[model samples]
Target: MKCIMDDLTVYTPSPPAGQNALVVFPQARECPELPPSGYAPLRGSAPLGRVMLRDGRSAWAVTGHALARELLSDPRLSRDRSHPGFLAPEEWSAEVGTHGASPALVADPGDEAPHRPPLPYLTPRRTAALRPHLQRIADRLLTGMERQGPPADLVSAFALPMSALAIGTLLGVPYEDHDFFEGCSGRLLRGRTVREAATARAELERYTGQLLDRKRHEPGDGLLDDLMRQDGQGSLDRARLVTLPGTLLARGHETTADLVALAAFTLLRHPEHLAVLRAGKTPMTAVAEELLRCLATPNGILRVAVEDVEIAGRTIRSGECVVFVTALINRDATVFAEPETLDWDRPAGHHLAFGSGVHECLGRNLVRAQLEIALGSLFTRFPGLRLAVPAEEIRSKPANPTSDGLLELPVAW
Candidate 1:
């Protein structure tokens, strides 16, 4: 296929002679150590280019920093999955794309269904109010890790459990229910088949719906209760309330868990960064932002063009799908000097790691708090922390190209 670049025509490779050729979406199967491919080649091309989805669907891949932010913020680009030609993740079936909201391992505001009430408690003030409680949660999790000693899988021992506990408490879900929710959420978010994901989603909604009913009569001291209070005050409907918690439970734990594990892995690989944290030379929060930029793992988010729109000198016809390759945009050389290098001391500006514009990550403050406390308390307790296995040997969940997670980050002190 031909792409117009600055009024010059460029041809993307087509199939060989007789057989149909597929423009395969870039996979990191070979470069497991780095971000996905396809992106590097597009660096010299137009801001928006083409890539074929696994389902044999063609979509635009937005890779430039400026264009990515522009398209993300543009209201003409709809995140509503119901739109015709909406692209679901490669793992999902076409039937899944035709359904309601797509399964998201990482939630963004744009994905919120129209019926759902706004998550007011995710505001900065509310996150700040929950700080002391989160501190206790982080400290307690780290304490358990310290007691267990090293040669432990951080994903299971520290990352997943800590994220589950913190988000579970905030949502008023019983801590005991976390194990079950975690299992279901994994299937919903990471399952390879649509049937598997749908089954997990149905089970999760049923559970959360039951909990929502109980909270209606017996209010608790968490966000769920707050939502229930809003429903009672005629601000939110019960049906929307029922569906909202499922989104929270599905997204809240998984992404943060991955962040914690990935951050730890990155630090272990760069002992000099770990040394800075031990020396307390820089604020953990600043260090956290730098690490977030380096470890930010969102692959790309699907958006459908609602109306004909021109972006980066290319016109996108209405109803066509476009994916903003966030991982590649976050590493744009124009924004981050030496974009590939991890520089804890580098003065970085607002990054798309949490996304941009109105659809920015609602849990940004909460995630920052979790990372700050989790990384600080963790390294403080284990000054001798080091990876138990070589970096190359560490495996990742290959089901998703965006995943920055290790299947198990084994560490020893």
Candidate 2:
């Protein structure tokens, strides 16, 4: 199998004439926790090589740190899902592909909107302003946990709901409607079927669209209200004003919530690291950064080549898809000393946990703020917290597109 680039360019490049092809793709039903052993086979091969996906689609996979960053930052690559041959992982490819503009899909009908301005609400000063409120939320959740007693699944009780509430507060979404938004957003992010995903997306849009209109009459101090004002003043378009909030609402909760659960799980597995936090020797910021690097979710970032470009001795033709295996890239041995170990004191270097280039995540500051507050409060409050189940028994939910998160994380103090 081979990837077909734009204009029917079919290049059957050999594996260095004498080298065998590297089977770097993860096998079906393989455990996600166990990193793929593909690197061993690619030792003598190029950093970028062809790998057959689980669905038998062949595309290029970028694993090396240097090459990953180069390709990610390259303008020749495109994030527009409409572009043909843009290989999304099997699970999410269908949903994303259908949502693109070209085919008049209901989810994202018009052309992808021009990039919006950096969220005016997420300024450092604003985040600092919101820090106390965030802490109060964290404290309230922990208090509820204390009242409810132990053996609680942090994913549902703490991580999931807390994340939802934080984003809801920012978007001016009513607290009473969080359950509906959370359910729809979960399916939108991780639904098993395209129909499931599309339905969830539609429901979220309907709800947010209504909320956006409501704010016009009774405005509040939230991003939604701000964007609504811009739209009313004609600075923002209707399509963007309608869709942007939904994107923030879903993504804002999904990724951060997963990080909270995963960070907790990582600390539980590495008691020595947990001790660092428990002893209060290392700053929570440092610990959060280390965990972010180490447990960088195994979600693969997808891109399409917009124009022919030579990278790493290989030509990525316009229209071909590329998968930057960030989890692999973050753990590259050359860039990170002792990359496997969790060291809070390790000097920070560029990591693609949040991605790179012009399309880097917009919510990063908000994410960092939430992580620091959530993790800082959780450990500080419950010094005796430990997993209710054995580490090996913990199961990860399938990557909804690229997010790898826990189904439940049972913990007790």
Candidate 3:
């Protein structure tokens, strides 16, 4: 099966001749706890190798930890798909080209936002400060689940709502409008076609523009208020001001939602490790770090080279694609001793679960706090919480470069 992405055609590309690529999503579902073994042959042969994309175009896959970091920081490679060579697929043209979002996508480091408005608001200190507030949100959601009883779909019951509420609260988006925004967000992920995505994008853009206007008159403590304050200083122009919330409000929450659900599932899969976590044998903070490293998104990041360059003993022509295997890099045996085993005792903070360089995840701090708190709250609230079905019965989203989250995680106490 092709990669499960927005309602578009999912393509699984095989390598041309000698090239190798992580070409399918079915492998990802075969084992939810690990990245596809297809990545193994590519990594085993070399740290960097040529790969094939859906278009039968070749890309460079960086599987090593150190090299992924070096290239991640290099400005020579760009996220701007308009570059002659970037060749961002047609589906992405609307998002990167039409949106012109300064902060980029959630997975995007958003390093390019020149004096981006949300930076001050997203710092680790500030996001960490939201912990108490976020905890209340998480507690409230978990309580709702308990009242409803078990056999609940954790993705809907706990993960999605928790993430949506937290991000909505952070950005000051009205909670009442979450249903509308959530529908728009899913469509944006992958529309039935480019047209559907474009429609979703347009609706979201309109909503954000209107929301900005509303916030201007009714100021609040959320990030949007601060962005308005920046706009007053002429720091943010009409385009950025109008789109910032839509950009943040959409990707910000969904990105964390996938991670939350994945981490919870990962723990339940490992009963012994879950026991250690429950007993506090290892720090929850450290456990969160390990989960990020071990189960980091496998799709990695894509960068287009503006100029021809050589790295890891290979030459990449300008416009060629560069893939960083975040999942594999975090599992590098050289950097991570026994990378396959999820060991919280080790120092795992340095892992590249989130892309690195200028585009490193802006939501990093908030996500960390959420993951730690969400997990802690989950087990504490329902000590007996466990999978409601056989492991194989669970469904994994078709693998996509952006996410491999479960369609729904059924849980019971």
Candidate 4:
């Protein structure tokens, strides 16, 4: 697809900051190192640089706070992949793989016929049906944690297993199959190599298909079973159904697990906040809101533009990809006061943690519930929990392309 840039509007920066100030550019590669300071205004006066995507296409990446928000919510800027001139960055396409079978589903939003198939794992109706099972699984997780004792790696122990059980039970995946699914899901998320990600996805489809078939003959009260009953709701067909579990496996569990561990880690780092939560001074709802903001893993959200649009004085043309920097948005000085500081008592309000608009995360409510229960119970049960390793030594994928997470977070009571 050829993108016309002759008419694209150019942004001119005012001038340089102090000698030590970093230059901001439109090229994602040229993105300035984000400081630990929560609110770093965009170097607006700096010239917008061109990002040459791995695929050889170029697009403008605006770092200005106003520009980011305007571009994100603009109607002309779309998330759909079906636009006529739609293209994906080589790195992203290589990672997500080409959507051959479900071409329409992955097509640019500008495509004449966009497919919006209902996913069994994330639908509200399915979630409702799976609640009882989820509660039971939650109980099992808590019990297992109690029995195993602390001074453990929360990532592996409570977070991973609980996530595995919740997602597995919802999809009717057998406990014995956890490792296979988990491994596939992990590879799918982490594999930077095209071949590896594709292979993992293929395996995931095969596994989900097998599980769906099993649920057919012996239908249970699981989400998958409920989805099978919704024939006319553009419910996932066989091929899509098979791929659906993998999406759920990745989306349902990984981020939530990270959030759980990260939330606990954040609280431990901020004892006053932890005390506020435990003392019942702050409602669970308040804690949930704060946790959503504080515990978000750093990958941010990704979306592509379907049409040309002007935002905050910059023109974002159609067929370009925009990476909405949610982490930066949440900490914008204009939005949050003393953005650098973690204030549990800060007045709870709107946040983009679950995202905004039509594509907002479907499992957001469940995620919040799980976090509330997990954090509230854990901290209340083990008030003295603290890091077992040096804070700096704690291993994390700080610049992870897909997520913000710690490989191992050792904690002791």
Candidate 5:
């Protein structure tokens, strides 16, 4: 409720009605790789504490690693944005209301029964099918970066393009139209206002539908064609057909680009495995896994109680919002020895970077494959890779508060 601030006792809402004082969600971040100082004290205090959102609403923050994972699989907690109790931040609540219920980014497949999506698109076997394609893209990007010379922004020249092209190839979207969807993803991911996000969402929807129409006339090998087959079988309707690829396009690429950049940034900072990477001593698969564990986004995921539930001697009322802190879960000292240190040999399975439960990321396999290829080719080709600017000069704050991405990752090879 109330956080200690150097001898000052500030009360949120005055606590006059006998309700607990609310803790504002954040304060300052002393380290770019870590959470804010204000948040530091809350998790240590209890597994579930009251967190006040902007605009005066409050939610419970799940602080413990075991509890966070348990609750993620608890059917009582729902991520359905359409739910009135869904604790979307005040800024974008209206934007969510503008869209109807579907298996879009707002909810998973079978959240609506009629929209159950085909399962094989991202299965491990199909993901393996994309490996060679991913390698080619990585090689081409590296060659281009080399020609452009040292001191390049990895986010723009490699990470961003690799993601865009990979998702494009998978979805059968034309390579020439990457700029269009990429602009939409930018607004939707980092737009300062709800209007910008809503406009971009609508435009992307229109474009996806038009592209599918074109695909029908000139059939190609895209996962969308799989959806088209389902459409012919009365399994997928037009709206579900359009929403899925748009969801994949927007949801798949940007955070992954940010993540790949973060992985490269972290490796350069530690450099413990720099020589190993260049010499091909450790497998790239292992290196990528460690980077994933060390650099996954440290943020809370929001879910709302669909019904009353009791846990840890507390009753969470229906419609109440719950947040599971991912950082605390992934970096628990008891579970992970020297939790902050990266060890390529350590087994880091079941990590929550892609989240967990029924809503676990559909792109997990694609991302893992992409990371292995991208990070492998990146450091191997440029053995002299290092940050162009000092690490401290790179500010950690993301362009959007909802994300933990660096705006630009400047580096040299």
Candidate 6:
């Protein structure tokens, strides 16, 4: 592949770090362009190489399939955002605000601090308790759909609303507040201006604090209430409980909603797979896993090196930011035969869709459950379901590397 650059220098990895690093660039595919917010892969290739980021700083874009996997699991890489000089290049840094740094980045690999429970409110016990409530929400959503009739946009009518409701119910937020939460989450993730993101964070924090206060005085049958009890027990702190639930509410819905929409889109695009799924004999479990793998994002995981380390023969200097492209690794032609082809029955091996290390997504089970029920019920409910708009015309969010917001997925009975 021809490498393109503007004021960027490319470096080929020396012997043993694999061969020359292949530099994937923008314009490699006909898909929607990436949002201008964060660093993400533009294309795929072999080995490691240096590229000048838009800020005029030398950065490494590790593109090799094997090398990306190796680097992702390497302990030398850190996910802590607090490391010195760790922000994106100067140009990018000027656009974002820094939050108080966490000790995660420099903490020892064995340290429990970085691996602290992601959500104090959504504890394992609370998650189990919320199951019946979740089922009720799912049932209500399906019932509403049945009464409203089909020929609806699943993205708008079913997937988005249902996800928002489930996440909100878990966090003690009313379903009516979906639009507010959605806007706040979107701004936090994709805001181009630092001030915008900071404003959103403050608003979210204030909202969560009020909710927590309500839970303390008049507890609801929700995770937030359970967190209040945990706090009273001294097992959780007030600040931790408040902030964690807000983060959970933001993360819980959006990604799963996208996955459900994308999985439907993928199955519909390949009618053969749709037929297999509709047979009702083959378990939906396998199909869900395959969809997760196939739809893996190109951006991978971000981590900074805590110390100088040698890997695959090359020495990685401390303080360098390393990104592992899971999307590229999952599709490695060597590990997965006919990687680009989606096989519903592909045998499960280790895939990085949920990530590899301790930081792997804690909500993996819930996401799988949501996808299974949502996709299965959707296909079963609307046998004639299909896309409303032309595939080429689908609108996506700016700065997002994956499928766009899936505008108006009209489906029919």
lDDT of each: 0.69, 0.68, 0.72, 0.57, 0.68, 0.57
Specify the poorest-scoring 10-residue window by lDDT in model 5. Answer: 1-10
Q: After TM-score superposition, what is the CA distance of residue 373 in candidate 3 from its true location, in Å?
A: 1.3
- Candidate 3, 164-273: lDDT as tens digits: 66776777777678677666766664455556655776787798788888887888777777778877888767677556655564456556777899899988988899
Per-residue lDDT over 30-101 for candidate 5, one digit per residue giving the tens place of the 0 to 100 score: 344554444655645456777776546787877665677788899999877668887544332332223211
What lDDT tens digits, residue by residue, belong to model 2 across residues 107-167? Answer: 2323243554436676777666667767877888899999999989998888877776777
Question: Candidate 2, after superposition: displacement of residue 94 in Å?
Answer: 10
Deviating ranges (above 4 Å) for candidate 2: 1-34, 37-46, 88-121, 175-180, 187-200
Candidate 1 residue-wise lDDT, 385-408, digit = tens: 888987777765443433456677
lDDT of 4 by residue, 1-413 (tens): 11111111232333344423332311221111122221132323312223333344554544334555555566676655434444432343332333211212222232122334354356665656656666566566666666887778878777766665677766667767866866776566555455666688788888777787787788776566767767436645676566666556556666777778777776776677777777788787678776676444534455567767665456667677666545555555566676556666776456567666666676776676677767776776677788888666665533333445566678888
Residue 251's C-alpha lDDT in candidate 4? Answer: 62
Clashes in candidate 6: how many?
Answer: 4
How far out, in Å, is residue 392 in model 3?
1.0
Residue-level lDDT of model 6, residues 1-413, one tens digit each, is 22122211233323225433333221112232211111233332235555443344445556455677667677778766557634332223221223211112112122236535435444566666666666666677767877888656776667776666667766677656666876675565444555665576678778888878766777777666766776787876767765654455445555676667767877887789889889976677788887777666333455678888776566668987665555555665666677667787686445667776666776776676677778877777678877656666554432232223344466656
Give the candidate number with the greatest lDDT. Answer: 3
Could you tell me the TM-score of candidate 1?
0.83
| Lowest lDDT block of 10, candidate 1 | 1-10
**Which 10 successive residues of model 2 have the least lDDT summed?**
1-10
* Candidate 5: clashing residue pairs, number: 0
Q: Cα-based RMSD of the predictions, in order?
A: 5.9, 7.3, 5.9, 8.4, 5.7, 7.4
Better of 5 and 6 by TM-score: 5
Which of 2 and 4 is ahead in lDDT? Answer: 2
Candidates ranked, most accurate by lDDT first: 3, 1, 5, 2, 6, 4
| Best candidate (score: TM-score) | 3
Q: TM-scores, in order shown?
A: 0.83, 0.82, 0.85, 0.73, 0.82, 0.73
List residue ranges in candidate 4 displaced over 4 A: 1-70, 80-117, 120-139, 142-150, 174-200, 232-235, 345-349
